[model samples]
Target: MTTLILMVAGGLLGWSAYHKIPEAFAVAIAAAIMVLPVYLVASGEGRTQAEEDPAKEDPAQVLRRRVQAVNQAFTEAVALMDLLRRDLDAQQAAREALLAEAERQQRLLELNEEEAEKIRQILIGETKASIRAGRRRELRFFLAGILLSAALSIPIGIWVNSIS
Candidate 1:
C-alpha cells in the first residue's frame, strides 16, 4: 500500500514539472517533494530480502517457529551441562584416589617410624649393658694391681732399713 502511494505522488510531480504548472522555482520544488517519497520507499525496501508472502499472515506459525528455536537452544545447553558434570565427576574421582594413596603412604611412614623407634630402644639397652660390664672388669683389674704393688713395696722397705 505504501509503495502505491509513493508511485502516485511521483506521477503527480512529474506531470507538474513537465507542464511547468508552478513555474520555475515552484515546479522544481514540487518535483523534488514528489520524487523524495518514492526514493525513500524504494531505498528502504531494497535493503531487505523480498518475501514470497507478507510476514505476519499466520501468527501461530511464527510463534511455533520461535518456540522450536528456543527449545533447541535449551536442549543444547542441557547437553553441555551433562558433559560438564561427567567431566567434573571424573576429575573428582581422580582427586579422591590421589588423596587415598597419600593417606596410605602416610600410614606406611608412621609404621616405619614405629619400627625404627623399637630398634633404637633395643640398641640403647644393649649398649648400656655392655658399657656397665666393661667398667666393672676395669675396676677389678685396677684394684688387683694396686694390692700386689703395695705388698711387694712394704717388705722391700723393711729389709733395706735393717741392712742400713
Candidate 2:
C-alpha cells in the first residue's frame, strides 16, 4: 500500500513536471510510474511462490500436488514436442543451406583451384570443417533432445490422453 501510494505520488509529480511538454510523453512517463511498481510487486510474489518448498506439506496434500505437477508437466511436454518439431524443421533448412554453400564452394574451387588465388582454399577448408562440426553437434544434440523428450512425454501423453 505504501509502495502504491508512493508510486501514485511520483506519477502525479512526473505529470505536473512534464505537463507543459507533449501530452503523449507526459502521459507515458506518468503511466509507467504508476504501472511499474505493481508489476514489480506481482512478479516478486510469483518468484516467492515458486521458491517455496513442498516437502513440509501434509501427505495427502502432497500426493494431490504431485498429481497436479505431473499433469502440468505433461502439458509442458506437449508444448516441447511442438518446439522440437519446429527445431527439426529449422535443422533441415540449415542442412539445405549448408548443401547450397558446399555447391558454391565447389564451383569456386573448380574455377580457381589451379590459380595462385587458391589461397581461398584455406578459407573454404576452414568453413568446411566448421560446417561438419556444427552439423555433427546439431544432429546429435537435436536427435537426443527429441528422443529424450519423447521418452518422458509419450507415456505421459498416453496416460493423460485417455482423460480427455
lDDT of each: 0.61, 0.60
lDDT of 2 at 151: 100
Model 1, residue pairs in steric clash:
none
Candidate 1 structure quality by residue, lDDT tens digits, 18-81: 6756434533453454445445443344333322244734757645654665565455444443
| lDDT for model 2 | 0.60
User: Over the full model, what C-alpha lDDT does candidate 1 score relative to the true structure?
Assistant: 0.61
TM-score for all predictions? 0.52, 0.27
52 Cα displacement, candidate 2 (Å): 16
- What's model 2's lDDT at 66? 53
In candidate 1, stretches whose alpha carbon ends up further than 4 angstroms from where it belongs are 1-57, 150-164
